[model samples]
Target: MSQLANIKQNIDTIIGADELMERIRAGKKLRIKLGVDPTRPDLTFGHLVVFNKMKQFQDMGHDCILLIGDYTATIGDPSGRSDTRPVLTEDEVRANAETYLEQAFKILDEDRTIVRYNSEWFNEMSFGDTLNLARKMTVARMLERDDFAKRHASNSPISIVEFLYPLVQGYDSVMLESDVELGGTDQLFNMLVGRQLQKDAGQPEQAVITMPLLVGLDGVKKMSKSYDNYISFNHTAKDMFGRIMSISDETMWDYYRLLLLMDEERIEHHKSDHPMVAKKHLASSLVAMFYSLADAKHELEQFEQVFAKNQRPDDMPEFQWDSLSGGETTCPLLNLMAGTDLFPSKKECRRLVEQGAVKVNDESVSDPKAILDKPADELVIQGGKRKFFKVLG
Candidate 1:
């Protein structure tokens, strides 16, 4: 394939085009850098969007550098936040790093990938060196960033440490002598800083590429743990399938185009011709990518049985009615989910209920105070498109 075609196939966005393509065609092993701050322990589907792109480059014989921003994470990235993030301790960052790698390996090849922590370089920098790095960018330029400008305009707190974040993140590219950098669209401002810093450091400018943000289950904000709209990599196959199924029907095409590895033409045709079938394929494709074909098939079977055939899921969690009833005439669904540990907290359960993502006995339940008066034989409760549990007495 031609170099441009190859680049297009692997990435959704490539900022520096002709020169980067020339480098790729020259048979030079491009050092592709992808940095993820271990702010959250679990890798969500959003992170996988970029990881999948990195996998494409690795498969194409490029060197993939996975930078775990342990050092910079301590400062906390203020990229898109409305408020400053609480800093994480070194121990906390290390603990999250272990799980980050374990989950990242689901898409990234351990042998072929280079996993490095920013602390290795950042820790050794002297106070003088830190000042030199800080001087590489100006406050005026930093203010150009959307988040910074928004915070500044709104009289929101924009700490001096927040300004250091982009510089530190940019230096990661310089340290690796990166040929290309990848991140989500939200990271474009920071990624561009890498290119600028590289140029300022008398190094060849690294190409910047950004992927579209993966919308959460809410189909509004970016998929994030804080928003309670993420599907973690650590979830069981059943949970993963259910989470994918819970996505808004409107998001099916977007997920198919971004998440699944299906042919674009085929997916586009399916979207216009038969959206329902397209979504089924998308859901199955995503499940198969994370799990196996057999597991994906099983999920589809379960989905069909429960959604189409109107039957109970075969492997639902068992709940005791006596334990749930508590002699109360009616119980809030949020309370029920919390008592059963189906959700982490009543807040999340209430959010799920409000979104109309929760159902009981195959019927959508909106009122959190609805009575659970049905016979205790097999009371089915659904969290979203995929999560289901059966209560028995």
Candidate 2:
């Protein structure tokens, strides 16, 4: 295959590839832009799909421009949403941005990355300037987006700010004078908007490339924090390893292809020869990528020991509490679970416990009415198939 063919095979979609290739062949180090809105605190494996592609461009010696949508996030991007997302405060957006870069650096080289905030230009735009910019695109074109059309058809509230999000994002490309832009398939609409804006500004239109979305462990919707189907990068090595193991077998190849960076032929060989071993290898590779090889090995060992041999690991979190003497003080199990962050809310806790999803130590606990007397030495709370926490007093 030609070099361009090889590149195209890996990329899901590319707008104006022939022209972009011409620039690359001319030894031009293109300014590649990748914009991310830090709506959630945790960066999931799904994010790595785009990050890895950016890493590819960086390795090829191009400048990688990371557009931290600190300004755009405040208004919220309504690209694929049917409803307006709650606008994040500047403080909240900044906090999430801090966490975002920290996790992103695990996949991206900080030295090579050009960090930028859209607020640099967007914040400086006057009402008159903003109006002039908004006038560049017609309302008919804006409503052509599937999200906006659906919302309009459904009579859902569509905020004017949401319409401005794409324009603001597109302007980032113009400001940076980007040669290429990278994003997930979901961002195709917003990305194309950037190209159109660049063309209108008389700058060379950026080549837009998008990668496929990574499905979550649920093997359903795209991996996302809103769905609670994500395995966070913020989690410990063991936690990450366990979450990878919990992924549906059907999603193993997608994880292998997108997350593990395994070659296609090798993946096919493993799928045909030894499927179970391939999954274990896939889990180990992913765990190793996020954590060190030593940590990944240790996690694998611990998983085998705990699940296969029914023996706990040596380094589990110890929960300690002073003994409660004499009186029977009762608190709702749901409240206790929520307080400990074992579950997000009382409703979720109650539902899990009632559905026989919660286990106390090794035994299943289905009774929501089960009251706990104070001072239990080792009270283990288990949620679903995997999540477990210990209570000690």
Candidate 3:
């Protein structure tokens, strides 16, 4: 694909970018800035939409500036939020920022990426300096943000610190002198704020590119850790493949376009196949990116073994029988599961059993009250597709 066409792929909107294509064709290596709040220790696939775009920029010989929002996260970004977000301490923000880059580097090229922490500058600001920064935006103007407007109209509690979030974020773009800034479409307002801040700071305004929110495995809500519908970049190959497969059939096309970058024609061909077949290909392709082609193939094989063929996994976890039982000849299934720490408590174990998610010796056991005799030789326990343990005497 032409570089111009490639840059436009998977994007939701671009603000003040009428001349962007002309400049890209001119080819003088633009500075692309992207910031992520380190509220959580893990990065989600939702993050990859912009990350992939950054990768595209890097391949075109541009600079990728990754700002870790160590300081902004303390104030909490109020975008798309209805209520005041809980503030984090300096220590909490520092701790959470630790693992972000390890995950980010999974997609971003380390050599071309310029990493910066917002705290690096924020931590050095004097009280007067902060006040000067705060003067950049008025409360009346801040209230113009859609989310803030909604919260105000409904009488929801909006905090004072929340008002400062965009200004601080915008200041990052000014500091970086970025040519372009990237974020999700939900962040269009904040990203545009960065552009105005740059112009006010006597720098060239940065164009904003917003990518669409990747739908979660549920196929309804946006993929987010808070929603528990996210696939973490930290997942093992098999787990990652399985979660990708769990996405609803309707959501497969979105995943194909956003995650796989497959063209429309290729995607239509995938749509012509069985849903499971198409899903497997998606899972394998993603797994290969994060892991390896070898691991992806092996993961698909393992999935087919336990799920498609209804056979036990070759490498089942082992538990010493007498020691695991904690001295009972026969125990309730819940007790056994609890002792293994497979479930948090016997109540949760009973819930899974009653829900028919528990399996023993390759057979589904739906009886929460079922008594499990001590294993004579080997006992297989499976809570779900991902968990399997073997009991041994």
Candidate 4:
């Protein structure tokens, strides 16, 4: 495929395609803009969907802008909301913005990226300046947005501040003089607003490219931290691999397409293998993206040992026998597991025990208050499916 075609392949929508192609053909070092509001601390595989496309532009010698929406985040993007979003404090936005680049650089080339906080421009605008910008769009034009329209139709309270979000996002493009703008499909309206704002400013309108939202592990909702379905960048290699593996086989194909960017032909080829085999490959590839190949392989091997073979891992986290129990001859099962980092809380550990999810030395233990004899050797304890601990004397 040609360079433009390759970039266009997996993308959901590309407005002003001819302009984008013309600029690419002319060898223009286009300013590609991807604006993200730092509402969440961690960036997930969902963000990777667009970051991959941005990477393509960077590789082709384009100027990729990672715009941090420190100011816009306080308003929050009302793209798909039924209710008004909770406003974020400046401190909260700043703290979230600080971690974005470090995580974003995992996929984007750090040296090549141009990072800018929207606060640079938004912070300087006075209430009078905001009114002048707000005049550019009528309330009718604002309601043209699908989210706004839906809320309006249902008589939902649409805060006037929410109306400014798209305008604020659009002004970023005008300030940057962006050549190409990228976002999720839900942001199409907001991105187009940017394109229109650029046109009105007598600058060339940006080409809007909207990528599909990555489905979360649940396979229903879009990947989001709020939904608790996202696989974030900070997840450990083991957690990443296991979570990817836990996705339904149907959701696996979407992961292959969106996350891996595998074309239909290659995806079909992989579909010929056993689902388990294909899933493992998918899991390892994603784990390897954030971590090393060795980490991926180790996690894959460990997963197979624990889940497939129902055997304990050789490298399970080890704890000194006394470290968990203060050198006692016995320890309460719930207390022992809770003292270690194996479970999140004592209540959860007790629940696992009550539910028979916790096992001691490969034997199922079902009483939360049950006492265990501290083994002189190593006592292997399995906590749920993903956590394993070996207490050593």
| Whole-model lDDT values for every prediction | 0.84, 0.82, 0.86, 0.91
Model 3 lDDT tens row, 182-224:
9998898788889888888898788899999999988899998
How many backbone clashes are present in model 2?
A: 0
Q: Which stretches in model 1 have alpha-carbon errors above 4 Å?
A: 10-12, 320-336, 347-386
lDDT of 4: 0.91
Q: What lDDT score goes with residue 45 in model 1?
A: 91
- Residue lDDT tens for model 2, 4-78: 654565578999898999998898888989999988788898888888888877877789998898888888888
Looking at model 3, which ten-residue stretch has the lowest summed lDDT? 16-25
Per-residue lDDT value at 127 in model 1 = 94
Clash count per candidate: 1, 0, 0, 0
N/CA/C clash count, model 3: 0
Please provide the root mean square deviation of candidate 1 (C-alpha atoms, Å).
3.3
Could you give the C-alpha RMSD of every candidate to the true structure, in order shown?
3.3, 2.5, 2.2, 2.6
TM-score of 1: 0.88
Candidate 1 residue lDDT tens string, 1-393? 554564575365788877798897788999999999998789999888898888888988899999999998899999889999998888899999999999999889999999989999999999999999998889999999999999999999999999999999999999999998999888998999999999988999999988888999999988998999988888877778777777887887678767774567876678686666666777778777777999999988988898888777788788776577675645656666777887778888888888888887778987766666636466779886556777674
Candidate 2, position 231, lDDT: 85
In candidate 4, where is summed lDDT lowest over 10 consecutive residues?
1-10
lDDT of 2 at 356: 90
Per-residue lDDT tens digits for candidate 4, residues 74-131, read 9989998889888889898988998998899999999999999899998899999999
Better of 1 and 2 by lDDT: 1
Sort all candidates by lDDT, best to worst.
4, 3, 1, 2
